[model samples]
Target: MSNFDIRDLLDHAAAAEPAQPAPASADEKEPRLSPLAERMAALPVRPTYSPVIITGAARLADIAVVLATGYAALAIYIAPNHGYPLSYLGLLPVFALATVAALQAAGLYHIGAMRSVLTQAFRVLASWSVIFLLALAALFFTKTSEEYSRVWLLGWYVSGLAGLFLVRLALGLAVTRLTRAGRLDRRTVIVGGGEAAERLIEALAAQRDTGVRICGFFDDRSDDRSPNVLAGYPKLGTVDDLVTFARRTQVDLIIFTLPITAEARILQMLRKLWVLPTDIRLAAHMSQLRLRPRAYSYIGSVPVLDVFDKPIADWDLVLKWLFDKLVGTILLVLLSPLLLLTALAVKLDSPGPVLFRQKRYGFNNELIEVFKFRSMYVDQSDATAARLVTKGDPRVTRVGRIIRKTSLDELPQLFNVVLKGNLSLVGPRPHALHAKAENRLYDKVVDGYFARHKVKPGITGWAQINGWRGETDTEEKIQRRVEHDLFYIENWSVLFDLVILLKTPLALLKSENAY
Candidate 1:
């Protein structure tokens, strides 16, 4: 106020401004949250290294193997009085290997089964016990009865069974603890903001061992249109932000809580998010769609309409794998002489290795090397499968034609099922990487074509027995095969697999469709 210079007086007046008026009131101000709370409120989130189906599957597999091996070893060691000094050590490894292999096939080592620890443990105990009894029966049949004492066998069985149970219990406890800590959970994000999203969140949170953890809601609306906070969760950003967040975060699931009536929006969202390696589900709880109850899966009694489900889920795949390896091994052993003759014939007829290896698309679009009995001449073997194998082709050797037409050439794939873990005994038959029908890719031709690959492709399948085998030159032929594949996937059971396996020999007799 006392400034003497004219310039100084003017500068003071210029620098002065009306105060910001203290931002009205706290309630009127926008909600400010702490970084951690902000993150939680804005969640439909995942951690960087979240657990997945493969990880859970592997853990269960390891647990089963460890229990099987450790129990056998411990039992042998504990029963010192009934066996020859060190000769029984060899039997321990053999039993462990056989029991583990059998258990794996028995569906005792599946990730879904692992969740029900008691049930899985009982299954493990039953499988190993049966295998042990079978070993005894084999010894008796071979008249090697006096080699081991009965006392040793009984003691071993008791100790091994107890040890198996204890190991499973410990594993179950550890898995539960980790799951509670959010280490072994599926991180989920809600795609809509409003009342429906709120209720879905509440329902999901109420379930114990449900395995879904909601991160946050994403909606493209202003504050008045979509509340800043809905059902205790904040509206993080927009649909664009959801895409960005999904990429940045460790999200494993995206649940669209929007109504199913928004078909165009749903399809658009799917097109945008489908390429991500996460699951995309459309919440159909609020919808009036009159769908089958089986079409809906529950989360603590809260119904969610399934847009997509896990393929080859639970213990079915485990048993299928087991049957393949077991039967494949037996066949390999029994048919050794025939295999030798085939090998000799192939070597004499063609200038190539006894087994011809070619790359084919396996489960999940993974490239796998398939084995054949060298049906094509060395110079003409197509590595990329650019051309289809037609009847009476020049590339086919004299013996090759006979073996291929007779379906004997595919016997080598039994080894693929056993050793490579690429093929199964019963399922959809795999097509070539460049396989086409009606001038379009097999995947492109069908709506959920790739979904058939949820389980491993088989050497012989339901389609093969139903006359859908061999060259799929016509659209009708391929469509029939795909239909059979889908039917198999939808109604898969161990008995269904067994029936297909039994019918395979009969199917092979009708090789009219074979190339």
Candidate 2:
């Protein structure tokens, strides 16, 4: 693999034209910018909470089509003569599962497959044929072939094929439309502006169907060493500037072109880049050392080593969202009485709204309004938490002290989990954007503090259950809290979330740090 020719990575015929002279930097001169780039820049650099994975909407759509076709086939053959078969109803889910799995195995759902209408139709036919054959073989093996109607089976098979084809046709058109609208392309940036970066750019440009849009490059080198323009791409800024640029732009992937031999420099750059919620890849096309194929992920045949992947990507995101909504709704219903009573007590004890909304650093460092039952006098409310709520603070109302201590004040955030979908039931606890410790911001107290926000903020997190909750009067307190948050992100799992949730109530009972 190390000896793989670099020339094979690029399509010489389609290579990008020599880059034009470098335009003035955005900061140095008024440069004309694309409307999309301009809008992204003007937007506040908040943590974007978008599902980074391919929207499962398409997958779900395909599943629905499979299910619908199966039922339609059953109805077409059975309903006219003997009515719907009760046994067939149970078989629908199994068939749908099998069909989806087959399609997945055949790579029909891949982004590349969606680019061509003909290719999608062909794959659909092939996958559907496999499902039909499997179903027939199962029937034959079970000796149940004689029990079912041959006419019904034949009609169902024909109808299912047509249905699958039509669905793929519609999906192909939709993909085309979305791609044209710039909704389907991955926003990519190159990290080094040298020969390696140029080669990767040319490779990506040749495969336009790969859906990678190389916006620009970010390098620390000077123009004389690393030209301002590389293979029709300009250097946006330096390595540090890449962080700010990434925050401003909807950058999805950052490809590092620096050779792997520069381990110290690469590690230093990664320390800065990993904080942003984006995939970081080290280009390996020019590397001398070869590793197993499993070690590298490909971006259109060009091998790159994965440095850091955005956590809970693709289908995992969908699963987590479903978990949050299902549990959040159940919790809201089960605890409605306590929630109502808490609202009333807060209303009677304090002259403020039942719920208090405070701006907190949410997923990707975006400011989200986290809801909580009001626990302070209306006039003395510290929205920013500029003053940490100390024990026996006079500003805390009578009911506020009890709620804050017991964590009942946090109940309203269930709405944030179920309704707004911003906060998860388990993750790092969201802190007020201006939350401080000894007059220093939490980020200043800890390295990679912003990295914790890569996942959504939660009502109860690892930090709280680990006894790192409450006032961060000392720097160590905040440091420990961040430490726990990062650990939770790295070691996240559904079982882990359940464990945290189970431990949270007991932790609350202790309330050693609660104000």
Candidate 3:
């Protein structure tokens, strides 16, 4: 495994908030910063969480498709030429369908299956063999045996099995590389302190292939309850800090080292953190009570039971991301002329840059610069986004008005899709960094707000096309938008992404959400 360290980030954090150096005494006056110094001081903030779930999911799907197709194709090719038995070709499709059904039914396509490629390969082989045998039995019973050649059938079956094994052998290494690069990983946070958290960290470190990167930890008590460092990982903050961290850090799993006996406390903590988009698991190491073997998931030998799970994980995410980049790139290339014209128009109609980059909250509540065409006058632009663009706001330039209304101002964000790799072509729309609904942070208002970050924010999202875009000045608007975003996250796919993309042009024409 390649060495990875987050020390630079930590050092930057420490320097940014330079410790006051425990005062000579609580009585001595503290050094004061000048107004400029105060203004320049910035708090430690983690980058907005980036979505890996989709990427991981897509990769898994690709692997499954490759193995299934390769196996079926090999089987058809090697089936000893059954005397021009074109009827054997019919069996190919049947075998392929059966293989897919069996694979899905056996759960061999799941993200968790990546943990044990050998075990999973065996399951796939078993399932595929069963399906193939069933198909052969059906053919025989139907008196279709004359349509096949025994030699061809034997060759096909043998080759097909070989192909399955080969695909898995190749995939095992690829998946390991992806997971190690932090591409296919579960963001985890330690929930207990001292020895428990330390042991957990050491174990996770020992098995980097487990794909569980510690985002940090949250302990209720301060120095007394937790140590300054647990297995070289600091206490990022408190449980409250964990909530904020979950919002700001790219986290997916939260492992609670506290036993099941702390049921009341665990439940209370879950009530607070469970609302975020993360898998909450109770680390079952210290528990005297044992659950059924099937009831728990293990990292090496340490067992954990599920509490909450971030939805649309692994291969699902990978497929969605692939679709976004591929389709988004094609669209951008095709529409470059239109994008250029829009930029020229913005420049001629307004005394500002053609593109307006706004700080928006991205995955994990980290700030990202989202691109748009300048719609408002240079001086009147709202940096904090406290004021919503109105129907007749004088600050909006002539070009801004047209682009904003027609949704052309968003055209520049395609580069954002290609460049920063922040937004996708389809998914949930990312809101402003401080977007408020009902005078509360959107995260505070919406349960599992960060969950939406499980996938990339899109240029045109499921919510926007469904009439949930534009100025969210009212609580209902934000609530409805969140609802749609959540819905998209829960039921995501490449086909779904394609559907959203195809429908977006028509949705843009409607302009119900556009100001």
Candidate 4:
């Protein structure tokens, strides 16, 4: 729609595309993904802390200071013994809440503010003073001045301020250490080189503590056009290389220094870059084109077009991980009897291993071994999934048929969801390495196939619940599955996951395609 923003348009454009580039075919001399993997492996993997986690910790720290000091002040000065009554206890919470609200309103919890001791102290003192002023106002209105001691209120205010400074001093030292180690800062990689990138880099650097640490540049131009090194950072590689690099390590932000007017290059870059789970920003500072102010978010003073954002990121990632761990463990415990019975069934029916471990594409297109109860005979086990198992297929044992039909064979992947930390309880289903439909590899049959991996694969998924489970015997079947997968990814939430999970039992009843 014309009214939609550029980011929304770019995001949907790739998914709507009929076809996109696929990895090199088997006939090619060198495979595409192997080299990408090798290149990624060569790069050092660095730790990255989520901004949400950092900001949340800062908020908790503020609340802890106010609440702890409020209690201490109450205990020290006529807290209960001479409080005129037990009424002062109620006011402690109000005072603590007021101080925290004041500090939040002052924006003292922002990443930029957290990095600076002077900034935090000045802001904290101002906010604390304002709260105390308000508390005095409340006390005057309530005529409770005669009831509580002035020393108590003053001590609470001063002690709260001191607590804030002490806590933040420790946080400040930690921030400095994290900054030095590239943990706290957003590890950024500029996608374009030249004066535009140099200008952007200089602008960020000028701000000193912009909270973004430039990792380097990734440009498509030749060395003459775009030098190997620019603005004191090396040109790591091209946009294609950037994707591989991101898979290897944590790349928090991807900024395109190229002006917005370079639509073709921007779109091209986006086609490849959209698959990454990182913030993608198109720097629009030099572009003559402008949209409403709300359309852009700034990095320091540089204006940037908000493009694709990583899905299930920050707190959502944390929450999903927690949910998987908690729920998966419970489910695993509750179903231990069933799992044991199934394992015994598989062992008795077929002389193969009780569990099957097949490599499947996981989050960020990385291979994660998925566990399943062995559903095929030992000699005929299709590890690569090169052939589709059909109805009355000879390889399918009697127990395998029942488990596969009932979907109990996938229960062991609870380990993947719980212990391994690679799979989610509900997400796009990860496919075997050589999974194919209609004799064509999934990547070749569908455009943007790997895009489904933007989130961790799950044992159950939107596609599975929507009649897209079981065999993918045709290209159309896989396409529909991928479509459902992308839809689930775009609209994911805890509630959505719960709904899909609840509907799974009913969906499993119609196992006509399960074989």
Candidate 3: residue 160 lDDT (0-100):
67
Candidate 3, residues 179-287, lDDT tens digits: the string is: 5565655667788787777777877787644667665666776656586556766555556556655553356679998868888989888867765767788888777
Worst 10 residues of 2 by lDDT: 1-10
The per-residue C-alpha lDDT of model 3 at residue 511 equals 81
Ranking by TM-score: 4, 2, 3, 1
Candidate 2: count of backbone clashes, pairs at least 3 residues apart or interchain: 3
Q: How many backbone clashes does candidate 3 have?
A: 18
For residues 1-515, could you state the per-residue lDDT of candidate 4 as single tens digits? 01112233233333331111236777853223333223333545556677578778777877787878877887777746765346777786787677778878988766666778888889888988888887788889999878777888888888888998897787777777777676667778898889999888888988965668776677878646687557766565678867877776677899998876688989988998888878898888778887888888988777888898889988888889988999899999999999999999889986879999898889987878999999999899998888888999999999999999999999999999889998999999989988889889998899788889899999899999989999999999999999999999899999998898889999999999898
RMSD of 3: 7.5
Residue 219 in model 1: lDDT: 73
Candidates sorted by lDDT, best first: 4, 2, 3, 1
TM-score for predicted model 2 compared with the true structure: 0.83
| Winning candidate number (lDDT) | 4
TM-score of 3: 0.67
lDDT of all predictions: 0.68, 0.78, 0.69, 0.81
